[model samples]
Target chain A: MTGRTIVITSGKGGVGKTTTTANIGTGLAMRGHQVVVIDTDIGLRNLDVVMGLENRIVYDLVDIIEGKCKMHQGMIRDKNKLELFLIPAAQTRDKNCINPEQMKELCAKLEREFDYVLIDCPAGIEQGFKNAIAAAQEAILVTTPEVSAIRDADRVIGLLESEGLHRPRLIINRIRPGMVKRGDMMDKDDITELLAIDILGMVPADDRLIIATNQGVPVIYDKRAPSGLAFSRIAARIDGEDIPLMDLGPKNGIMDKVKEIMGINRGAYSNA
Target chain B: MRDLIRWVVTRKENTKNAARNRLQMALMRDRMDLSPDIINALKIDLLAVMSQYLVVGDEFQEFGIRRLDESVFLVSNIRVKELPRANAN
Candidate 1:
């Protein structure tokens, strides 16, 4: 069967698009499906580093598009044994290097070979964003619970609707259940109501994600990490598995009370 | 006299509620681009002319024009106090 193309995007920056692309690709590959992640950031490529394949990138998306190399030559295999690959974007070139048509053609070719192709889209609703969405059959919009992020996500949803991309699934990233309970930040219901979209999953704000990214490791390798498990659940959903979302809230515990007393602000509440 | 006072209070409250509702609907419609600026401008001009005829008091409620679908509404409450004969002249 042909692969499904899924573009992971958020109109606002720093909402974990690249991280999600990497982890979901890893998660899907772990399930025995061949997966490839394409970083569409072009001039600002970071997915390679996030996936720990930066040094292995001999050729990039631009090189493949420009006919300097075959498509397979650009795909970097993961450090683990899973059948995951990375097509890093060219850092030297800008977004203008590849247009929507070219991206669509490339994804179409990749889909014939792989079971899943995840595109890590750039920030903003400009040409780069358009290029990423043109090739995908499914879209996963990532956003935090903050007002600004939610507002941008709403705008992005409107744009997607205009482009005929209907019913795109939502991934509310960096949620803090404690903050939602305290009424200090917008909750899942608040975001869902405002955006009026079906939610695929919610990922809590986990610090280990930073360490994992820095170490050139996809967080999905660690089953114990909250963020990693969240991505795995998202992957399962993508693969037609019915997995429940993770309970990110503070359960009954003395440590939870200590965290509240220490004033460890939760997710969106930290800024509010 | 008590009936007259109650009637006046009820009228005032009803007017205020109507004005608030109109403003909210108009604003929402305007945001959705269902109401054009031509109608909004016309509503503003009408409001300005009406203000000159009414003895609108300090407690007068002002509501911003809001758009609701295809309709434009003037959402505000003006206290139309009766002017004395000398003041009217």
Candidate 2:
């Protein structure tokens, strides 16, 4: 089947690009679609560790590109039983080890076999960034609700537009509802206005995400986690569903108590 | 005393408007890359020449000169009631 190549990118580091790629890949695979995630960060590879497939890498992207190994030999299957796979980057090689043409050729080959090919782009607006975007058919920009992150996201959006990638959707990560309610941090609305782009999803700052990542398990498998549900909804949206965004604030009254009584968690009740 | 109070308030408003107008005109001229000093000198020279032709009262109200782009404009808000009409002869 023909596949869509979606690149998960953010200009600022530590804003959850790797986490997003892992979760979205897991969510899409859980929906029974064949998904392959490629880590484009040549030197500083972390997607393998995040996906818990670090020990399984015999050959990497550089090996496949350098004709040392077959493309299928470099692809590592997920520990779970879904049709998910990952092509880990070579930790020893630098960004110059592969170029955009090589990446585009690799993705074009993978697209024919998988339903979704998600690329985990490296931070910065350098050569690594250009290589990642060159092969992407769709782009998802991840950003935190901070001024610096938003500014960098805007700059990234400008660069993407210059490359003829228009109207890239945004994903607001690490939003703390408490801080937003206290007016200490900018909310999603503020970020959306400043960035002026469509929002694919909003992932809350859930502590369980850290625990799952540390345990080499994606949070999307933890159905009880808010961030997990958010990722699932994002995957569903990508599958062409019009699912409404989940309200990630803490519960505060009879409605929450009713949800507690009914055993309803995660987007349990509607405000309207 | 009431008339004096009204005059004071109105005079303050007029001064504020004049200041705002001058600032706007100066900013426009600056953005258009014109020399303000040259424009001011030209306005003074034009006023002097106009005064020799007729009694030019209230220099601030009688005329205003501003530079717009590469051109200059002269605006006059004179009291026509005080001046003799062309058919007065």
Candidate 3:
């Protein structure tokens, strides 16, 4: 019943876990909820950088957990979203610097004060994974359509369930519509069928995402970007909204369309 | 014409489908606290045991993927065959 704590994680690196966390955190805040995004990637902090609050992090999560500073003192509020805040990780500390119990306690404490606590988990299922998942009541798994990413995701989902974190929703990132349409890449349907999990959203490979990350700004603020729209829908879904998944279905190419008009239209590739 | 229809229905090997099937098997094995080779061995053992119980001159089909321990893991089914008893006794 307390504020929901959801850990955003991907067993594979560079699958956009941090980006999803930042965007979803910002999206929730944009809807007027008090949200706190925590960087649990310890030693390799990036949530702060992605959120553009790196310059304002006076104290980090390790400091708060270690009692070196008050919890509130370590939280850096987003300059753009007054309702959204960030608890940056300590780049100087290792995963051992804070244990799972400490992180769980932190979540318990934050639950009383915020609407959502989003933890940006470190890649790989190790001590850092244990620490990041320790406090989460729910989990959001991020992965790409690639074989390596999905393989790691399957492993991570197994790991999550073994830890009693069951039914974590999935986010398929960096999907290329063109590739999927041409059957050259993994489609969302295939990925969902493989993982056998509820897919929260799918973000198309968008150049704007890279730009947003470089500028420490989330694409959700742009509203026009496909990835931004996807994140917004995901945030809404998390909020108990029953919005239908977006239609990124494959489209018929010009040649295919032209063939259909002709009498010689190959009925073979029509369904495809 | 028949070949064209077959080709249409039988979509080419897509990168996505390949990834999906691989992931599905991997996750199932993983959640079961086992590996691919282990599950395959289990399936083989299962067939052997099933054959032991089959009547003479009888046949059976192999089981498909089955859920084990709720969501913990899935037992990979290889093939259903005649009860072992039919062939043995």
Candidate 4:
């Protein structure tokens, strides 16, 4: 089948590009589609560790491109599912080792076998970033609800559109509902306005995501985590489902409860 | 108690609002590939050059980024009442 290659990218680092890639890849696989997630961040490869397949990688993306190994030989299957696979990036090789043409060709080969190919792009808009975007037909930009990240995401969107990767959907990650409710942080609405892109999903700040990442088991496996559920909805959207976006109302703590009991309702929870 | 009452009444968050202001300025500056310093210098130079030809009003002489339709403009609107008539009565 000719698969859709969607690249997950963010212009800033630590904004959850890799996490989004891992979760969305896993979520799509959970939907019973054959999916492969590729890490294009060659030298600073962390997707392997994040996916918990670092020990299993004898060959990597560079190896496959350099003809040192077969395509499937370098692919590591996920322990959780048979439908998912990951092609890890080589740690020793730099960004210069792989070019856009090779990446495009590699993606073309993967397109024949998988239903979805999600590439984890590097942070900066350099060669690694270019290679990741080379063969992808669609894009998913990940950004946090901060000025720094949104500014960079806007620049990345312009660059992507210039390359004909039009209308890339956005995923605003690590959104603190409490801060947003207090009007102390940027919310989903503000971020979408800043970036001028269709929002895919809003993943709230969840501590369980940290444990899940460290344990090499994606939060999607937990099922109850807010961020996990948010990611699953994103995957479903990508799979052409019409799921409504979830309302990210902040969790009312003890103070809020007291205020509510006293009839001094905070505006954030007034609608509730 | 004044601060607490003000907070309760106005619901104003100073730091975040201030950040939004800074972000707006920075984003506009980045898009035009010119820093704030450059823009400020340009404004000063423009005012100096224009003062030689016309009298600029303090109230209408403005320099900042403004959004129009879908485009962001680095605009400078100067109100000139007319060159202080070189040979007026």
Best candidate according to TM-score: 4
User: Over the stretch B1-89, how does candidate 2's per-residue lDDT look in tens digits?
Assistant: 99999987775553423433444454344344446677567667866776655566545554455566545676666432255457866
Each candidate's fnat: 0.00, 0.00, 0.82, 0.25
lDDT of 4 by residue, A1-272 (tens): 99999999999999999999999999999999999999999999988888888888899999999999999999999988899999999999899998989999999999999999999999999988899999999999999888889889988998899888999999998887778777888877767776678999898887778989989888888755778878888999999998877668744678867764775533223210
Alpha carbon lDDT of each predicted model: 0.80, 0.82, 0.82, 0.85
TM-score of each: 0.75, 0.73, 0.78, 0.81
DockQ-better candidate, 1 vs 3: 3
Off by over 4 Å in 1: A254-272, B1-89
DockQ of each: 0.04, 0.03, 0.48, 0.32
Across residues A1-272, which tens digit of lDDT does each residue of candidate 1 receive? 69999989889999999999999999899999999999999999999989888889899999999999999899899999459999999999888878999998999999999999999999999989999999988889999977667767877887788777888899999887666555555666667766779888888887777888889898777755677877878889989988765455776567657765885424222210
Model 1 residue pairs with clashes: B26-B66, B26-B67, B27-B66, B27-B67, B29-B67, B29-B68, B30-B67
Misplaced by over 4 Å in model 2 are A254-272, B1-89
* Real contacts retained, model 4: 0.25
Candidate 2 lDDT over residue span A1-272, tens digit each: 78999989989998999999999999999999999999999999999999898999999999998989999999999999469999999999899879999999999999999999999999999999999999998999999876667767877887888888888999999887766665556766767765779999998888879999998899999977878878888989998888987565657778776875876655542211
Better of 2 and 3 by TM-score: 3
Clashes counted in candidate 3 amount to 10
Off by over 4 Å in 3: A249-272, B1-13, B28-89
In angstroms, give how far residue A30 of model 2 lies from its true place: 0.6
Off by over 4 Å in 4: A251-272, B1-11, B34-89
Report clashes for each candidate as comma-separated counts: 7, 0, 10, 0
